[model samples]
Target: MTSPGMSITQLLPDGKLIVLCGRADDASAWQDLLGPARCLAIALDDAPHEARPRTLRGASDHLAWQHHAIGGLDGSGWLAEPADAFDPDHTATLVLPDPLDPPDAGNRRRFGFRRPAWRLFEDKTMVDTLWDAAGVPRAPSIVGDGTADLSVLGAIVDQGTGVVCSCQPRGAGPSAGGDGIWWWREGPPPTTIPTAGPGTWRVRLMPLLEGVPVRLHGLALTTRIIPFPPMELVTLPRPGQGTFLCAGAVPLLDDAADLVTHTERIGVGLRERLGYRGGFSVDGILTPSGFQPTDFNARLTSAMEAAPSDRRVLLHAVNLLAREGNEPDTGAVEQLAEDLFTIGTSCTIFGAATHADDRASRTTSVRWDGDRLVPAPSGAADGRLLITPSPRGWLLTATLATARLPGGGRVGPRAPEIFRVSDEVLGTNFGHLVPPFDTRPSACLPKVALNPEPATR
Candidate 1:
């Protein structure tokens, strides 16, 4: 019998075609999308025990990034472990950003000119100009020339409307989500400067709107878009951390469809107009009147990483539809996608102790001395060396713990103790199936948040 299909071909400039797989998508999408020029499919989901990682690395005739979602593509701690031998590509896989441009035959860069529109997102000030020019209504802001006058914030605040404050190259003294401190208050900007005084700082201030905040994560690939469901954000106050305990996305938004449409249009604009590619998210408030965009992160935001199990079909389908090929068998694909979405969920919830910057300081754990759980000294970093590409390190650690468990009679981790979520942190739910994922209530939320740390998407 033929195995369930997965790997597909990518034509290299060297006139050779390389086989690529290991992402979540099954091979059928490529087969349905690419038709038949050359097909050497290896459906990982159906591979035998002990043969999985070996199966993946065997196809590494050409080097590629490790995709942990499919498993085995990353190395194992097991003896005689059949996992990927990726010494060359491991560094790029850890701190993921697109790889730097490689020089060509005459040592000239060929695709450097075709860079993604990361500037429009990372450079928050630039995002303002680009979104404004595109006529997308975002929060109003007061941009300032790097001056040390926190006094000027008085004018915007004294008007009785609360204002949000931030500075360039963000991520110091009171920032969350992205770098740069932000706060909601009814008066003039806080008198105190969180970091260094101006001249080196470019600032932005906007009136705080009392609306329901939501975040949408999606892909912005060249010539296409892959939008995920809208997530409602509950901003919990954390007086000590400056940033709140952030989480959400259930009780279903009253008008989720409209939010999706608006978001996808914005995503499309980013792709077609400014030449964007890769993961991104848009943060906004869902006012009683309508949704308004607040922040646009060019790179992947935490919410995208927390994607619901069911959205996988939507994600893979978009990639297939974007390529040139025989028209996809949409009905067949959707039915399969639907089944996968409902039953194939590998996780239920995610968590995180979000801060705008400095992850190394936050994830330290001296908590467990065998049977005793004790807090480690601040900055105590001791544990097996586990690295995740995401900014949400805590969530990555939990997921790896759960996923590596012995499955179908395989050897799992030696020490089988993954951390559990704390009661204090609020969590959002995933999956449309009933009766709870593992008998845990939706509020028993599978992820976590601890002070400035917890589960994340």
Candidate 2:
């Protein structure tokens, strides 16, 4: 039975169109999220907000799911009916809320793709300014003006300390280099830190052992450690508490309750600070000290859909779409969430492909192939979860589960996972097509860190 106080409006599918934005959340994830219920999945042709349908997958194919476009609408409540409204060729009209609408703006700011807080939060130099104010734990950080000596970076880490480097524009878009690097005293000597075309990049500092590689991801106040290199120190905040880790690497969050609480706090705090209208994620490190944030993602992140079943992360999706500013009742939400978690009905996020195309970028599938996350090849016919990049980055709108990782890691925090597929390989063997890519971009995303590199998921 649905939880009491759970309004029908909360579960309303009426006029609710679930849209797939990019190669993320292909088909399978869509089916898993929307269930066998009838739905349509449409692909948009443009980037950012210039959304136009390049292809359409119908619901009958088991490949198709419900999708629509919320193009060019501000925060007001004024709705813009497409010029081709009722076009004979089209089956439905495009609907959007006004940007000026209070609830609409609030909702948009809360869940929209552009999250500004992540920028201010992840700046290592900003440590003294914002960390304590946000209720985040404090740690030793080495800051740079982007022009300091790399060896000094090593000194800052001293003996047993980790390093965090923030690289800024060194040259042009693809040519710009780094701002500076951060590390702890225990890490190895500073190696070449790749610079990206001046966008925004942040790194987490931790003790690095000999031959350990550092290929981290995330921007500004949120960064995650790449698990390819084993880590010894990890910290996690108590569940629902205000403190959190900012990095993306999950290996550090070994405790479930701690992860849930800190994650909730980080999620709620970020939404409030950034005026972001979409998804944002904060990565963390579980050190002996506690869960400390390493970095932040202002847009839809890989973690958005990874929560275990009983968590019903779909509620997050629903809440993201609801009127903003009005915080949901924490007590009531906790009660309902507990019920969902107890039933083992959590949500997993996935990505989709255009035409079973192997060129799909980003992590799309999560199944255990002897304990690692090996992404299932994506394509329209494959029925994998679908996701798309908007002006804000990647958006996750679907979900699924694949073979469990070996050992007893538990696929997504627990066993008996949801929507298990037969591992019927789909799409072309594009694994080669997706190069782990130079995350740093300036150094051509730089070759995978020498020692411990990212293990393919």
Candidate 3:
């Protein structure tokens, strides 16, 4: 859905179309309450955010160090600086990756803080408490400080399927995926808690549910939650050891009434109470009993990559706001979201390879900052998703529909024809392919163009 006052258009440069957001969402009510649009503009800057490590919750002035793992978005919508570091007039958006904890009354005064992100989303534990308070159905689990409680886990896993443990820290580190989530293979649970080893580690244990996983998502100030279909997790090992592939995630979320309404209420309630805004997610498992929420994320989620609405929702949120003296069309933004909902089913397939060497560049950078694909200084700042298609191989990063992924499965499926191939062997056919020549241009050979034509020799 678009902002009441904002619209998006495309322009072509060099024969490629570029998407641009024009006009702006009217923010008279927000302005009347908060004063100035700059207060909301703070979310767009990268400097202060990059200078420190930022995650969705439980941040404090005394404890803003970057953590052990980075999140899916590479760290957009985050900040490492203190609440007082940037004035409210300098805030990027209603969302902050490191907004002051909602309970921090002591620090609220530093910014005169009319509209700081009220942090209801401090952590999974905090959310669990809130869900209980709201009488929402949640999966049963235990949290430990990364000390494996084999007895507890074994008992829990034995009751149902198995247990999946998510590391309680945010931010990606070398070879750490989804902050290093681990699943207990089919076996007897361990007898004792494992050592914390080296870093700050904690784990949230959840019993594997029998139902499929689906995502309930929303963005901007609009509370219309869209339930998109669940994505199946696919994995192909790399040379080192990790589920790396032409990663596709069309994580499930579709407009299931029971889940959608609750998600909206929760999302809107959080925004209204905490003044927290921007992209937020609540993932649930679709069981025969009903939808049961198992996870909550207060920032742009990994599933956002699989959601088409994400780009527009983010763009609408960042659209121009009412200046100091202007009057806000109070209901315009709200009405637009309610009436103009238009995001189709989304499926995201990231990490397309344009060359065998492409994997090398991809492994080093955040998923968004691909070497040969992205526009210089990458980010969708101008309302465009990046795609640098080359003759060799093209990198595709998009919020498309479920139909797009899997290259559209077979029509008359007799056990379903496999479209994409994988290998039990890692690094079977991936590596650097450098030309034998010292390819750098110099005085000896300032310019060199190997013939486009194949040589007989």
Predicted model with the maximum lDDT: 1
Mark the regions of model 3 whose C-alpha exceeds 4 Å error after superposition: 1-122, 169-177, 188-194, 197-200, 219-255, 268-278, 302-346, 351-457
Q: What does candidate 1's lDDT look like per residue over 229-310, in tens digits?
A: 6665544333233333333322222335555566567777676666665546677655544556667765434442334423
Superpose all Cα atoms of candidate 3 onto the true structure and report the RMSD in Å to 1 decimal. Answer: 17.7
Residues 43-78 of candidate 3 have per-residue lDDT tens digits of 221224344433322212112222211111122323
* Selected candidate, larger lDDT, 1 vs 2: 1
Comparing candidate 1 with candidate 2, which one achieves the higher TM-score?
1
Error of 1 at 321 (Å): 12
Q: Distance (Å) between predicted and true CA of 335, model 1? A: 8.1
Q: Decide which is better by lDDT, 1 or 3.
A: 1
Error of 2 at 153 (Å): 1.8
Question: After superposition, which runs of candidate 1 have C-alpha atoms over 4 Å from their true positions?
Answer: 1-116, 145-147, 157-161, 170-178, 188-193, 220-226, 239-242, 248-253, 277-279, 304-457
Candidate 2 per-residue lDDT, tens place, 1-457, comes to 5542344224434433333333334333433554434333332223233333334321111111111233332322112222223122333322221110111211221222222344444344453345455566645555544434545654555444334444433221111011243232333433445443223443333332222112122111222111111111111111122111111122211224334444445444443454333334444333333545544433333332244432333434433443233333444443543443331232332322233434544334444454233445553221234444432223333343222224422222221121113111233111211111111111211111111222121
